[model samples]
Target: MKCWWEHLMHLPDDLSEMGVVLSRVNNSYTAASGEPVNTVQTVSSISNREVNSTDSEHSSVIPIQSKVCEPEEVLIPALPEVACMERGYVTPQQVYNLLNAEEGQPALYDPYYILVLDCRSADRYKDSHVVTARASVTVIHPALGCLISCIELQKYCIILLYAEYGCSPVGSVKARADAPDLQRCFFQLSDLGMDPVILLGGFSAFHALYPFLCTPRMVLVEPERHMLTIYPSEILEGALYQGSATQASDYRIIKNLHITHVVNATANCPNAFPNTLCYLRLRLTDDGQQDLVEALPLASRFINAALKADPAGRVLVHCSMGRSRSSALTLAFLMQHRQWSLLHALRWLKERRACTAPNLNFLRQLITYEEQLFGSRLTSLDDIRR
Candidate 1:
């Protein structure tokens, strides 16, 4: 039976090749073919020349059976190996962070600009749906190519599609129970030479996790993203997050970051989730005259303990403003673990968070510590770019 998708969009329903969703992550827009998009004429013209050559010498006669019995060998062309989900599917937690700019992902600290396509029916969408998801009813689809062009799907860094029950892409390209909109959107992106991520477990799973984030309103003020933004700067990819007291106080930020350990470099800041998260609260202040040498061994021991407990665990370090104390502690940690010079560490910190400016005294202490560890003082605050 011809799939309904093949009828409407003239696309193959066999989504076996769809596993390339992870393999073909184009940071920018590019055709999947890796060539420029061409007109339908590029679809190989029907081969017209008939094969005339034949084994004429061997024809009209069968080879006599050899004394030794032998079996015929068969040859078959190899097919492409489907890529498994390495980082293809996005979880509800990750999606929330991607939109809010609070987790470890390609988006980093920036609020990921995304395009969300809701695959449910208009009525179902009207009831309530994921925040910032574009209802299928709101979209018009007279022409597929023109549709993507009108919406400028290429502009988004992340494109997400969700269904009602959240079926696997290999089994069902359609997003909802019986809707082609999701599959249509998938092909629309594929046609433009892009791969869109599927929301793991779909709306049902997402809403179950975060019911308050959904609403009946079809209008998106920001037009496809979360509202409130309070997240930490990713210092070391998925392993470490650096933030201020404000983010540390925000329970949402801590939970989303999956922070297993927290290094609190403040005398006044309370351990917000003491029962939940392990904290190494130093009796240090942001006065720039505090003793980091005394705190360094303690904090490093705490961090190493957590990693030993679970290597996949994540850690968060926060100070009053993530400027002086926290940044210094983070730098110290990097200097110890990453074997980076104070100069290199400062540059790396600033590259991720411009607010990372340890005070003059703190810089002196860091220089002294670096000199002790690596046997030389190689950096000054002046050497680092503003």
Candidate 2:
């Protein structure tokens, strides 16, 4: 008999023809270790994922997979990892998301979990810099070298660097003498395994968008001292929020975002604020075993209902980490509601979120969903490249 993946992923089916002792019993797949393997479609989706390969051409993730991975390891790149692999850049909005605090998550306090390094010239940095951001070169306080060595830099969850202007890519200026210190600071952090991202628009872009968040003071106000509650990611303009357990129980955040309806998209996470908010809990796991095709339309109907309820009515779709299950559901919603292809839907969502990575099996299921919806997976890896 053929391997389960051969049927599910539509692989060449020649792998089963190889000398392998693989058999499916009662719809259960077992690997060589005899462990009840859930799903191993990584090999089936490598052409679509972002990788740290030698070839820079396929370095970035475009949210479509058409290759495979070895059973021993999977290196699916989700930005900022994807961004790290090639662009070495991230949007300032993604930076704000990391700094935005949650009830149960790490604190961004005295020993800040998220470090913002201002990689500007000493003179420029001293005049004014982003609040809580340290200068790459020491002007007043510890320099970049001192901070990296003195502090447990690796402990920080998110690390960011920015220059005077970040509107353009660094390639145009990297060859210039005494250019911005963005490259040095970026590499040092990368060497430590703490993936750092250069702010896409830099200080100029950030300050313009959020003048209130930017400041000359290297200190935080009383309000800023405490971690800020996370606002949901805007999946669409119509008050739709894609989020996690962080904002699930925060009534203030929910109300602030005008999120009256919630789609609890996890098997473990409870329906927070059920009494106050409209709820549709899809008890799903983060793994690939659970099929999401049928539930996608169910979620679509529920989301539409909320929008129809009132012009101001909003919906929140959340799982535990707000990465896998929730991301998949959000992609499906776009495909069904906006009539977007899978690649188009994924791209739209990923632009707003760096954490929008659906697991491999969920990806296969989505492909099946697209084939059923639009007749075939006509969007190829080449298509995604274009």
Q: Give the least accurate 10-residue stretch of model 2, judged by summed lDDT.
A: 53-62
> Judged by lDDT against the true structure, how good is candidate 2?
0.60
Alpha-carbon deviation at 115 in model 1, angstroms: 5.8
lDDT string, candidate 1, 22-138, tens digits:
111222212344432211111011122111111122221112221211112221212222335644577775665554443232243232366677877878888998766777534
User: Which candidate wins on lDDT?
Assistant: 2
Q: Each candidate: what lDDT?
A: 0.59, 0.60
Error of 2 at 13 (Å): 42
- Residue 2, model 1: Cα distance from true site in angstroms: 63
The TM-score values for the models, in the order shown, are 0.48, 0.48
